[model samples]
Structure formats: C-alpha cells, structure tokens
Target: MDISLKNGYEELGVAWRRGCEFLGTDYAIMGGAMSWVSERHLVAAISNAGGFGVIACGAMTSDLLDAEITATRELTQKPFGVNLITMHPELDQLVNICLSHKVGHVVLAGGVPSKETIRRIKEGGAKAICFAPILALAKKLVRTGADALVIEGMEAGGHVGPVSTSVLAQEILPYITEVPVFVAGGIGRGEAISTYLRMGASGCQVGTRFVCAFESIAHPDFKKSFIRANARDAVTTVQVDPQFPVIPVRALNNEGGKKFIETQHNVIARYRAGEMDLATAQLEIEHFWAGALRRAVIDGDVEFGSVMAGQSVGMVKSEQSTADIIQELVAQAASAFSDHEVIRSNP
Candidate 1:
C-alpha cells in the first residue's frame, strides 16, 4: 500500500480500534447474523477475512447450536460470536452452549434481552452485545451490564424498528458512550462505516451485503433475487389492520409478502367475526412467516419465501469471496483519507 493509503487505512483502523479490540478481530466490521444464512461456513469465512462473524442462533436447539459452534471453530481460529434470540424457548441453554465453546462475544438480538440474560453472559466470561433501537433502551442496556451495543435501524432486513439507520446513529451514538456502539441497517459501503466511526460508533454491522458472499450457503435463487433488487424492491411488511399489530419486517417484496397482507386481513376479519380471539388471530398472523425465511434462503423459494434484505441490497452487485468483500469495504473507507492526503500534499 502507498504511504498515503497506508496512513488512511491506519486512520480508519484507529477510528474503529475499540471495536477491533472488543471483538478481537482485525477490523471492527461485524457480519450481521441472518438466520439460515449465517451458518458455520459464512461465519467462519467472515472471521477468517478479518471481520467478526456471528452465528445466528435463531430457533436453533441446544444440540444444533452446539454442533454449529464446533463446526465454525474447525473452520477459523479467529474470534466469532453467537447471536441468540431473546424470545427463544431455550435461551439459557443456548447461552450455556456458547459458554461451553468459550465464544468470545455473545450478541443478544431479536428483542431487548433481560438483565439476567446479560448478567449471565458476562458472568460466563463472554462479552454481551445487545441491540438498542432507541436512545432510552441504549442507556438501559448499558446499565444492565451490556458490554457493547448495536443500533440497528428500520432499513435493516428481517425484523426492524421504525427509525432509519442515520437517525438512530445520531440519537443513540452520542448518548451511549460507556460501551462500544456498533451501527447497523443499510450500511453497504466503507464510506458509511467510516462516517459512523467518525460519529463515535465503535464499528458497523452489515448483513444484506454479505448474503451474496461466495461463502454464504443461501440458495442461488436467493442470491439472484438480491442481485436483481433495487432499494425500492426491498420494503417492509405492511399491516392491513393496525389492531392486529404486525411487527414490521424489511424484506424483498414478493408473492409471499403480498400473501402476508392478505393473511393479516383474513386473520383480522376472523377475529372481528368472533371466530377466534385476538391472541389466536395474532398468532396466526405471526405463524404465516415462521418458516418463510428458511424457505427462501435454503430451499430456493424466492417467489413465496420471505426474502429479507436491507436497503443496501441494491449495493450488492455480484457474488464475491468474503475476503474480497471485506477488502473492498476497507479499501473504500481507506480511500477517503488517501484522497484527502493527496489533495493536501499537492496543494
């Protein structure tokens, strides 16, 4: 690398060095844990490429998670974390599995984790990382002994909050300084990562961009859907009736998405007619997409499965190696500084 570029890279490193140290990775960039897609192969690949990888323990049983951690360990000696859904039936057992494997970091995602969950993770000697959608929750997580925080905005794929990434960063980044805060949602480029780091974020998390990584086990059809999508193509699920209260999920619009709207309407109608109680109606609506993500990701059901993707899906052009993807992001971030140095010297 040229001295100017080297300097630029070093500057970028300095900005996210806290994240690097916390994650024990070469770069502060974290691979977003997309269930069914972020398995052992992709997780290990991201870590091996100098970025932190996280296993998505979404709905995985204790034995399943145990085997996955072991498989990922065989692939990469680098540090990686496991993401556990707070709503999982066996959350405690999953945590135990991670601790047994001596995982360095544990990301508690899906919803606000209980203080006891955070305490247990820390007590097991692994750092606890939680997602804070808003400023108030960010502070609460910190007080609850969260070692790190990831502020994910609505633009992110899968389940999301209402705010945009930029807005969330501004709201939570400044207030939560006790621990490292990683920014997520719609972050596809290195420039965005650099911008967040400059804004006092310790690092950034990316998911949609990694779906097309060569190491990802997602169906080819799934990757093609991402490649063919524009920002507008990736949209959040719409609720036909506000009373039923469907959680907003950002995903590529498809037949399944359209069906989801119809399903919500049907469920609401049945509830209004007294065919079922409100709880049963809501349960039916939620169950509609239960296995939808896995269908699209693993079984090539792009037309009907939930193809979750962020607004950054538009930025993914082609399938590339995990290392190449990380390198591109790093290069893009470093170039900003290099360009500035070149201008300064010539002037």
Candidate 2:
C-alpha cells in the first residue's frame, strides 16, 4: 500500500490514486451518472471538486448531448465521462459524440451494453463502465471489455437492482479478473464510503450525495426533501408489473408512489386495448417521473413529483458546494479508517 504520512497530515491525494485528473482532482473517486437530474453544471462541479462526474443522457437529444460535452469542456479542462442508455434510439449517436470528445470514460447504463458498443468505446481509448446487478452480469461485462463496473444495490434511487450492495459487492469483487469494482446505491456519507472500501471496492461512485449539492439542477424542493429525509423515509414501491418487465427502484413512499401503482393498472388497461405498446408504457413510466421530478426538484412540489431517493437520504442535511461535500466525505472516510485501525490495534 502507498500510504504516505508527509507533513504530519493526511491528504486525499496521498491516500488515493493520484495519477489521472478529473475536474481538478486526482482519480480517487467518481460521481455516478444520474438521469434527468445530472446536468452540465453539476457534473462540472463534481469534476471541479476532484472527482470524475458523468453527464446523464436520458433527456437530451443527440445534438444537445454534443453541446453539453462542449460546454463541460469549457467549464473545466479536467477529465470527465458521459453516460449513455444502451436502449435509447439515439444511443449510437450519443456514443459517437463521447468518442469524438475523447471523454476519459463512458458509463453505459439502462440495459446490458452490447459487446460491439464496449469494443468501440475501448477502441476510442476511453474506459468503458457499466452497471451489473448480479455476479453473472458482472462476469459477462468484464469478458465484454468493461473497464469498470458499478454494483447498485436495492437501496439506490431510480431503477436499483434487487440485491443489497453488501451482498452484491462481496459476491462480485473477488471473482472479477480485470475490471475494478465500484459500490453505488445508498452511499451518502463519509462513513458509508469507508465501510464499502474496506469491503474490497477500489472506490465509491456516489449519486444521491451529488443530488443535494447546491450546484445540482434538481429543483429546490427536491433538495429540501433530501435534507429532511432519513433512512426510514426511503422506500421501494411494490412491483408495478407493466406486462413487459419492471426494475424495482427505491424512492420516498409518497403519494407519487401510490399513483404509480394506479397508473400501472391504467397501463395494463391501455395495453389490452392496443392503445400503448410495452416500450411506450415503459417510457411513460419514466415520463411520469420527469414532470414530478422537475416539479419536485425545480418547482418545489416535493409531494407530487416522484422524488427518487436512496436509503441514505436520511444522512444528508443541507445543500453545500460539490467541493465542500467531497472534501467532507473524504475526511469522514479517513476518520473511519483511523478509528477502525485504533480498535484493531488495541488489546
């Protein structure tokens, strides 16, 4: 281990990998890609604070995505990545733009990324990252040339997998032959990051933490909900089977959640009448969220919008700059490490 104790102090650069630049900091951590919520300014803020920030591509057009990449470059010369949902109609175009920008990395979320897509990303000299819910998928992604993997436990907001992060990270880390593992989902504080790192993760990729950052574009109301939330407030809705497939995601157990259930029944009714196809209905599910999220995050309608949040929302207290949040989190993680060592060394 390259543990340095220079100047009677602990610098994050000394403890973490200090080679690559993301935003203006070293390559020790990354902010996860969040949809409809992660935009240019917030992404740049995370990068500026020394962590790699990935721009989410859910609501942008191909041309808009290109513009965002260009805008991000103007914000900071530090390295960053772009996220592309594999199932989108414009996935190819979005991927091409990221390649053209020479993005430091590319995170492919949504469905399982194709082998061809992974190959293209690697060929363009960019590291390919993907989310794998289970061990089998993680192995397959590694074989398909994934440079890294994000294992999202059920506690994550917006389309989390079924397994817990504890179980999934432990299951996948040891067997991975090439790709480095990152634990996401429900990680909001300094202590949580340390806890996961000790579990064999190379680093942590945080999402919900960034959501509350002052720079985040999520509506003010949304941030307030985050501040008010505790672990008990975050809950996953009952499986809303859309007759196609449903990825159970965690969120606040609010009126929006109940409405989603009623909406699903409507979808089932509409499906029988041939008014909607599975794809449209699925998109509708996502669409329903946008208005509410926009209202909640931007308009201040906390109760109406689908306030997608992880279990760690309870830990978040206030809106701070991205750098302050990052620095605080790192400090917390270091503290945990020190305390753990003291306990183990005693007696």
TM-scores, one per candidate = 0.97, 0.87
Tell me the tens digit of each residue's lDDT in model 1 across 1-347: 68999989988988889999999999999999999999999999999999999999999999999999999999999999999999999999999999989999999998889989999989999999999988888888899999999999888999998999999988888888999999999999998988898899999999999999999999999999999999999999998877778888999999999899888888888899999998899899989998999999999999999999999999999999999999999999888867766888899
How do the residues 211-268 of candidate 2 rate in per-residue lDDT, one tens digit apiece? 8888898877788888888888888766567354656667777888888788777877
Minimum summed lDDT over a 10-residue window in model 2 is located at 1-10
Best by TM-score: 1
Supply the global lDDT for candidate 1: 0.93
TM-score of candidate 1 on Cα atoms, chains taken together: 0.97
The TM-score of predicted model 2 comes to 0.87
Model 2 scores a C-alpha lDDT of: 0.77
Per-model C-alpha RMSD: 1.4, 3.6
Looking at model 1, residue 101 earns an lDDT score of: 92
